[model samples]
Target: MLHPSLAFEKGVPSDATAIPMPPPAPPPRPVDLPGVAPAASTGETPRPPERPAELSRSAPAGPDAARPAQTVKEDGKAGPSDEAAKAGETVKPTASGEIPVPPPRPADLSGSPLAVTVAPLDDSACRARLERLGARFEALPAISNGQCGAARPLKLTALADEIALTPPATLVCETAEALARWTTEAQVAATRDLGQPLKSLSIGTSYECRGQNHDPDAKLSEHSFANGVDVMAFGFAGRATISVMPATEGTPEATFLTAVRGRACDFFRTVLGPGSDAAHANHLHLDERQRNAGHRLCQ
Candidate 1:
């Protein structure tokens, strides 16, 4: 039997304290917190603030702000802390506006001078060219088909006189100059026969270093060295008759002889025919007197 003034209320919560009420449930924290910090009284946020969001149990918070509030993104977090940029570390902007810089461009090359020169002939190279040309060098008086002998001055008087008696017939040439001229011409004519090689020369009558008329006592003649020329045949005339004499009246032999003899005067310094002498009846001969080396008549 409780009186009206002293009795407790009928449905009062069991956990209620007497004087003051505690706060509702608090946010979770990493540690046993002492107390919450006082919120800013200035009404502005410290970091870049997110949009005003509705209080939610289903949505995220604070992650949407990509940068700080006041400073630009680059100046804000890009490099060392604010202390290092002040220490002169050469920081620069990239095209993408990140921290590290790109490398520099190269310089120009338009003003340089350039040239090419061939190396000169060495001993080995010169020997190679000579060997390829079939040049054989010898001391002195070396015999038969030697290079120097082929280039020698004429020594035999009879050989020279005999050569002087007529113009070469059929591809004949006299002087070394003339011979060199005829050399290529003769080759062009000879090689048309097919399959044969181009040889250096087969000059049948270069000057002969022989005694004059086989006479050792005679004055040194043009044939003493190898300067005079006697033409034998052209293009395997071995198979053809080499004619330089008088005609058999008016036969084709006469016409053929005349035609070939005319080609001779083109190359010889002196030209002769059967009318020149009995010894010249068989073949036409030619030589370079240098004085009389263009063309002489045998009439």
Candidate 2:
């Protein structure tokens, strides 16, 4: 019933409501096309395409950025691997797929007390005799003071038979030669009588730069020239020790001590023991001193 011009005009009637037509159905997606994504409904705007994780990871980090450091085990601790790098070494894989280990370092002996070494004595004759008797000795320079000194000194460590001296001694070669003979003849025989072989001799004194009996005003003692030694006790292999003292008298130990003293007179010019003066009470003093008319003093 409305006129043609009114019907074509864009106006709403007072009593009527307008029903909008649904947006044209979205253009049919091109299912047959390759590499083409389906479009969204016409009214909505499309979001930018999402980037792939691989592309994001391929981006390069700038220099000066911190990198993950390698780990190394040091002294049982985990630490950075800069030590090897600083040393100009590289960690490379071996043919067997194993890491090569470094060689172990030798033990440090510089600070050890036992590291001290003494050179061998320079006397050929003395060295030959010691070598023949299986004695261990080191050559030492002359020890001198005022009018007293020991020349051609030797540091005795052990006998030829591997008998170790509890405490080694320093002596003149001549005295050592005499002592070696005495040890073979007197000490060995005496200890054999007791069914206990001699292990070592406990020496009280050897070389000293002092006067007789440590008297400051007296003449030089035989010890000053390394021509004397004081034997305090004899140690046997079974931990048995016999000291030269009056208390050991009236026992088998006394018999052995007396026998050795008697035998020592043949080798030493003077031999003093427990019954001698107070200075020689606790030990036997044997010395190779020049005597008058080849006479010997054995007390």
Candidate 3:
């Protein structure tokens, strides 16, 4: 009953009211976007799609261009700071978009304080003290033998009250002061126990460049620095000489020797005597060597 031309134009029979277009696939339900609410559930109006990352990046850059989004973690947290810090390297970008290089690490200067060279201290005040102690001395040229040396060595010939030092001795001002002080004690002991005045001291070693106890492999002796002395015997003005050997236990020589040796510890940091060890069995070893906590070695 429908005309052919009309049927062709309408693409349906005239008796049919309409030709159904395959139901437009229920306009594909929109997928959920992160951090954004769905229009149907949130009562919000639909909007255009966001600009793609690729399009945003391809756009011409300007001073007002948006910065790239920070990377997100698996748990949706923000990433690290703009400057990425790594071992020995720090990466940061400048306004011109160039990454800057980090500074170099400092070199190690870790070593012993003793290894560093230092200026010697002025010895004027020490020399002044020695003069006040009634010590007769004259300065000698500096002694330099590798690690064995003295900045200011003195040639000491006499101590307080003119108690002579036989054959003179090489010493620093400090050791000379200690020797002078100890000699006064020995003079007192000699007058009290030996019934005579102290006259001279028979010197043994002073300022020797050698190790302790004459051992080449041992630690350097205080004498290496002109800081030690060795007394071989004591000569009195009227009485017979008293050697540093062990005397009779009940004799006045023993009493005088004991008194002098015990008092030497007051002025010297180290005092070794005839009974201390075999190395010091025949004499007294006195020194001004420094020690920790002001400790002394008296044996």
- Which of the numbered candidates is closest to the native, going by highest TM-score? 3
Please list the residue runs of candidate 3 whose C-alpha ends up more than 4 Å from where it truly belongs after superposition. 1-117
In lDDT terms, which candidate is top?
3
lDDT for position 176 in model 1:
44
Instruction: Report how far off residue 11 is in candidate 3 (Å).
Output: 47
lDDT winner, 1 or 3: 3
Global Cα lDDT for candidate 2:
0.73
**Model 1, runs deviating above 4 Å:** 1-205, 211-220, 232-240, 292-299
| Model 1 quality (TM-score) | 0.32
Residue-level lDDT tens digits of model 2 in 155-253: 887774566665777788877877777777655665566777777888888888888888989998999888898888878877578888875556677
Q: Model 3: per-residue lDDT, tens digit, 171-198?
A: 9988898898889889889888988999
Model 1, span 207-262: residue lDDT tens:
45555344667654344444455554333323443344466866645654565456
Model 2 bad stretches (over 4 Å): 1-123, 247-250
TM-score leaderboard ranking: 3, 2, 1
Candidate 1 weakest ten by summed lDDT: 156-165
* Collision pairs in model 3: none
